[model samples]
Target: MEIGLVGKPNVGKSTFFSAATRLEVEMASYPFTTIDANKGVGYIRNRCPHQDLEVECEPNNAPCINGTRMIPVKIIDVAGLVPEAHKGKGLGNQFLDDLRQASTLIHIVDASGSTNSEGEPCGKGEHDPRADVEFLTKEIDHWLKGILERNWDKVSRKLEVVGGNVEHAVYEQLSGLGVSEAMVVLAVRSADIQESPKNWSGDDLYRLAKAIRMKAKPMLISANKADLAGDDLMDSLMTLGDDIVIPTSAEYELALRKASESDIVEYMPGEDNFKVLRDDISDMQKSALDKIESHMKRYGGLGVQQTLEKAIYELLDMIVVYPVENEHSYTDKDGRILPDAHLLPRGSTAEDLAYAVHTDIGKGFIRAIDSRTDRVIGRDHELKDGDVIKIVSK
Candidate 1:
């Protein structure tokens, strides 16, 4: 699944992207630093079977090799969203368009409330992160509304004939947004549409838009610049409810990674402390590096990893499944079972997995053997995490 990182400019979105993917991008403390979307593969680090087996292994059922351990998930960093984005303000249409392809959204907010409504640095502004959060959601909803409005005559006319099946009409309108047919079905079934379009209240429209938005709803707020946010900001953000708000210092993590690569300091991104590897570096520089490293480890990669994973699993309700032929020796397309992990949406059945492998296997119906338990099950069997399935097909 693909996830998009979105927020107002200079809220550390690029920094988060760079830290997560370890790819370099231009990051600045100003608006519109990223004019276009940047795409990269972010790997979810997990132990693979070959690593666990500690031997050269191969799988007869699926493609894999020896000692492969991690799988990659795509991440797209879109341009910043501004007020009136739905109305075509500040590259608004462009920003929203960039997100059309993403399955989930990670709304990265400046927890410290250091920026104004337009994403400008406000040294003395109140830390009301809720405004940014709520505003961004509304913008997206209205953006979709605008699309519907443009096609209202055709969509509304169709809805009149279909009656209660207005959901289908709505789905047709949203098909361009990259929403799948299954997702549209779910959204329609879950939405509450009125019998008469004119009778629909403002709240009714809002709810319909919300249902569509929830199909690609965002999760987790990366409370960036946490070290600078302090207790007042933390308490204020806690009041926003039980949403996973992870405190992070993207800037600090980026600095630490750069310093480590440059050999200026011996520090890791997720480690709390660092040993002074360079004796030639000044004491002030060492002190500065130590503080940043402390922030990185304490906040844990500035919540980049947690936020990305949380958004994928919680917002999108996805899971990681490993399809392998040999539980003892797993492998991939290249015959290397280097970390056997594939993130898929929950409720994925065996047939779905066969499709993931190849259409030929899925088309030719057959039984599957669960390597972990050696239990044979039909094609409809739902897969669990780390499942090694041997598809006995034609």
Candidate 2:
């Protein structure tokens, strides 16, 4: 699944991207520093079953780090969005189009209220961060509405006169946005527009667009620059109540990761604290680390990792399943223990897992053996989190 990092310019979008993916992108205090979208793979931690199985895992797709399995998730950092972005303002269309494949989005807002609506540097607490949230959602809603309004007369006439399926037609129009037919149906229902498509009002269209965007591209809020934010500002963001707001310090996270890379500190992404590995460190570096530790202690580990994990595990409702060729030994054909980790939605069936492993394996139509229980299960059997199964294909 792809997670799009979105926000106004200089709200640490690039810094968050760099920290999360360990890939360098241009970062600056000015708006629109990122002209092109940066794509990279970021990982979410999962418990490696090999630890429980008492076997050394030779991973392939994902790496196992000290008993923790790091499952890769695609991350795209798009250009900074400005107000009226849907109206083609400030790299508007490009930004929205870049997020077409994103299953979800992480909105990085300056919680310190240090950035204006245009993403320019402003006085602290000058701009309300909550307004940033509203504006971004509104821009997306308008963008989707514009897409739906295109050829609306012809399409709506076809839908009403030809008695075509409304959900399917809408789904077709928004297929590029990763919108599913199921999402269209739910959006239509939630929109509660009883009128026929031909007679639907502008407001009705906007409502439908909003609903579709809600389901098609769910979002999590990252209240960035939290270290510089006051509790009152943080409290205001929390009162948003609709989205999950996480306080993050991307600068601090980047610093910690860099320090870890240099072996100056023993740090883990999600850990609340780090250890200074070298005693000969400069006083200036030591002070910076101490401040970062204090901030991390207050907000819980820089919030960079937490935001990513919440987007995947909670927002996406994904679970990791291991497919093994040898159920008894929990190894692939090459004798590597639990080599691959597949992220599947909660309630995915054995047949689905087979398809995920390979189309040929799924086409063969097989039974599966659960390594944990050694019980033979049919193709329809639903898989659970951390399941290790051997596909017995014909």
Candidate 3:
């Protein structure tokens, strides 16, 4: 799953990316600082079963630290968006296109209201961050609307004349939008447009486009710059009612990660606090570390990790499953204990997981054994979170 770190420029998108992935990108105090997209792997922390199984796991593909398993997910930081981005305003055209690959978006909002609508720096609270919340989604909606509007007339005519499969026709029309025919059908239903396709009005098409964008690109807002934000600002943004808003200090996360890299302090990305490993520290560095500690005490961890975990598992309804060759050892062919932790959609079946591992394994068509009990299960056995299953195939 790919989560796009998106927002207007200079709202800490690059900072968040750098912190999460420990990969550096340009961060300037100007709009359009990111001209292209940067892709990297960012992990969500979970408990490694080895801690409970009384065995030490040799990590591969995923990272395990102090019994916490870090499942990596791809994150893309793209160009900033502005008002009427669908109309090609600012760097809107390139940025919107960059978003097509994202399964979900983490909108990094300048919750301090330090950036104006165009991402230009301004006094704190000058621009209401709540306004930033819906606009990006609307911009995305309008972008989809633009694509659908281009062919609405011709496509609707064909649908009306052909009169067999509306979903296929609409799906074909939006084949480039990264949505499926089932998604198109649901969008049409959600739009509540009961009339014939040819009879759809401009407003009807607008609603339909919005629905399509909603299902195609689900998003969670990260109320960034939270350290500088007032409670009133946070309260207002929270009232915008996405319930998925995560207050994040990208700057703090970056600082902590950087400090860890320098061995100045021992820190984990999502942990509530850190430990000063070395006693010999300068006064200035001590003050900075103390300030970070205070912030963590106030609002928990820096929130970069929380945003990612919520975006992937909560908003996207994903689960992590372990597939092992040796059920007892919980090891793969190479004797690596729990080397692979696959993220699958909730309710995925054993066969689906087999396919996820390899096409050949899935096609061979056999049952699976529940690792916990060694109980035989059918191909259709639904996998659950943390399930360790051994597939028996031809």
TM-score of each: 0.84, 0.95, 0.94
TM-score of 2: 0.95
Candidate 3 stretches with Cα past 4 Å from truth are 23-37
Tens digits of per-residue lDDT, candidate 1, 1-394, equal 6778889987888988887665222222212223334887664443345554455544232223223333456778888999898888997877987888788788888888888889989873364877888888888888776765666666566667766565566667787687656666676557657456545545555666666787755556777878778677867776777667777777776776677677776653334566667789878877887687666665555566667667766777666666765544554445655324556668888788877777897888587777667788887788875566666668
Better of 1 and 2 by lDDT: 2
Worst 10 residues of 3 by lDDT: 24-33
Output the lDDT of residue 68, model 1.
Answer: 30
Two-way TM-score contest, 2 vs 3, winner: 2
- What lDDT is reached at residue 188 by model 2? 97
* lDDT of residue 250 for candidate 2: 93
Candidate 2 regions off by >4 Å? 23-37
Which candidate should be chosen as best, given TM-score against the real structure?
2
Per-candidate alpha-carbon RMSD to the true structure: 5.6, 4.5, 4.6
* Cα RMSD, model 3: 4.6
Per-residue lDDT tens digits for candidate 2, residues 157-185, read 98877887888888888878899899999
Better of 1 and 2 by TM-score: 2
